[model samples]
Target: MTGIRIELSRRERAILRAVAAGRGVLVSSCEPALTIDGCWCDHAAVHNLVEAGLIEKERQVPYGLATPAVITRAGEAALAEDPRST
Candidate 1:
């Protein structure tokens, strides 16, 4: 088996930074508390993170529809390694 190489894009890094600052967890697609030049994270970026096993999404029915996400251990490690993520 091979290992996955984590390369974070500028957008992805922004998302991770937001999550990390929120104590490593927050609602997916929620308005970012942190943004770069007022640019918040998008759905595609969240989906990409989920697919990469860097974030975990759980089903929730808050106000009838929503799913929250939390950063995974791998995600924390990734952020630690990627200086841009901080």
Candidate 2:
């Protein structure tokens, strides 16, 4: 396993943390997703996280929507290090 280090800006960090907290929240009758202000998170900001190696993306099951970004172990570490998160 690679030792990944992800650096996030203030807003990006918060958004990712929120998304992490909102994970597995049901988005539909058969799938799970997260929402922000009634906006289903396609998690485009995750591109930065991905470059930093903080998270990974995968295609949705059954429907094959855009790759949903998910927190990697490194991402959890980053979130934990953020004292502002709660």
Candidate 1: segments with Cα more than 4 A from true spot: 1-3, 23-40, 58-64
lDDT agreement of model 2 with the native: 0.56
lDDT of 1 by residue, 18-77 (tens): 665543333434432222234445767766777787766544434433344567788888
How many residue pairs clash in all the candidates, one count each? 0, 0
Q: lDDT of all predictions, in order shown?
A: 0.60, 0.56
Q: So what's the TM-score on candidate 2?
A: 0.52
For candidate 2, give the lDDT of residue 32. Answer: 38
Model 1: weakest 10-residue lDDT segment is: 28-37
